[model samples]
Target: MTRGTTNPNRLRRVDRWMAWALGDLLRRSESAPVVVDLGYGASPVTVLELAGRLRAVREDVRLVGVEIDPERVARGEAVADPPRVEFALGGFEVPVPDGARPSVVRAFNVLRQYAEEDTPGAWARVVGRLAAGGVLVDGTCDEIGRLATWVDVWAAGSGTSRAGVGPGRGGVGPANAPVPHSLTLSWRLAGLETPSVIAERLPKVLIHRNVPGEGVHALMNALDRAWAVQAPLASYGARQRFVATARSLRDEGWPVLHGPARWRLGEISVAWEAVAPR
Candidate 1:
């Protein structure tokens, strides 16, 4: 179990991104899509916050906050509104009501507590529980969530897999490993520093891999360089500076996804191959 450290609005960045990125998935569901918040900690505030944000995407979206600790589950149950927002006592098995398959399983700040080598197994287990076309968002953010990075993992045959990638490069692994699709970085631009600082908040699979000769390391270096190149834009605003930085990376072929629309919000996403472990 995690230390259960959390704060109000600590996950607003990722929550906003998920609401936008997965809007179609949520809206097109034949039934009210199920969304799971695996390992929501001591407080259910974030879970409640997530439920509120997702309702903007689909009013009937169901939320299930899963935790291994019974006490945490009990805490969540206290505030949970049955059917709309609920809590379950479980681990990566991801138990949900009525055996409903979740369309998105968010395991943020959860896997960082485990050994790096154990990441793939945990990912596979969570992804296994997702509904078809579902996505697993594995992420880590600072206490206040000013800095955050997450990788989007998809299940095999989910039709969400990136094209032209082979095993271990955002593709399948030796066993029933999840297919990582992309990496996204988000920052609160009000008082930001170097983009490389996000390296400290990388998700578990790529955290220790942030060294020389690794893809993630190279991406960090490139982002830092781009940030420098776009430094002049800072005089206009941090948003302008960040958008320019993202444009620079894309201009140099970093496989950066999204456009200035997202970058303007102090965010950028890149295909996982751009930063997959070497």
Candidate 2:
């Protein structure tokens, strides 16, 4: 059984990120986009909440909450409304009906309990069920959905390639560079001692690799040093210090991805390579 910890708006951070990053795809799809909230724990709140948020961008957004545990699935089913959202029993395979493929599959915090070696196959299984232009968002976050990081997976023929690649065979660019789509660090600004503290809650894939010599280790070390150096800026507030610290890191060539929009929220993302395990 998966950890059943979940809350009403606990996944807001990831939900917001998805709306922004995948809005275009939803808008361009021929029909209501199908989205699966794989392994939504304990409650159906997150799945329901996701449907509400995504519907703001595309009124036709459909959501299905899948849980491997029959009891959890039954619980979700009791609350899931028709058309807008539903629940079922399934695992990483993402069993959809009628040969249907989802436009988006969000598996958040679901893989954190699995062995590290299982991630690649798990990713492949879910990604294989994505529609031609669909996406698979694999991520992990805290109970309140803060301090999140997710990788956006595109289908093989989805017209998008990994980041840094040149135009494809037809000279068309990838839908969106397949970089670790986004990494959001949501910390309590006033008490944040070091960025490395987040390692404790990282997805299973990188949690064990937070030791010395790992890329994530190096990145966090640089962040801590940068934060310390920017101590003077804290006089303004932790937010200012964080922004300044982030800017300094960017100046140092860290590939910090988002701007003030994300930083103001106590979040920042860099290329996956910046923090991938060495």
Per lDDT, the best of the predicted structures is: 1
Predicted candidate 2 versus true structure: per-residue lDDT over 1-278, tens digit per residue: 67888877888877887787677777778977889999998888889999999998899888899898898889888887777787878988787655468888999888888899998778777866777667778778777754676666554446443332212233223333232433445565767777667777776767787788887777778889999999998879889999987898899999787687777677777766577656
Candidate 1 least-lDDT 10 residues: 161-170
Residue-level lDDT of model 1, residues 1-278, one tens digit each, is: 99898799999999998888887777878999999999888898889999999999899999999999999999999998989999999999999989999999999899999999999888888888888678889999999999999988877555532322212333454434588888999988988889999999999999999999999999999999999988888899989998999999999999988788889889989998888887
Runs of candidate 2 exceeding 4 Å displacement: 156-182
Choose the strongest candidate by TM-score.
1
Please give each candidate's TM-score: 0.94, 0.88
For model 1, the superposed segments whose C-alpha errors exceed 4 Å read 160-177
Count of backbone clashes, every candidate in sequence: 0, 0
Q: List the residue pairs that clash in candidate 1.
A: none
Q: How accurate is candidate 2 locally (lDDT)?
A: 0.75
**In order, what lDDT does every prediction score?**
0.87, 0.75
Model 1 Cα RMSD, 1 decimal: 2.9
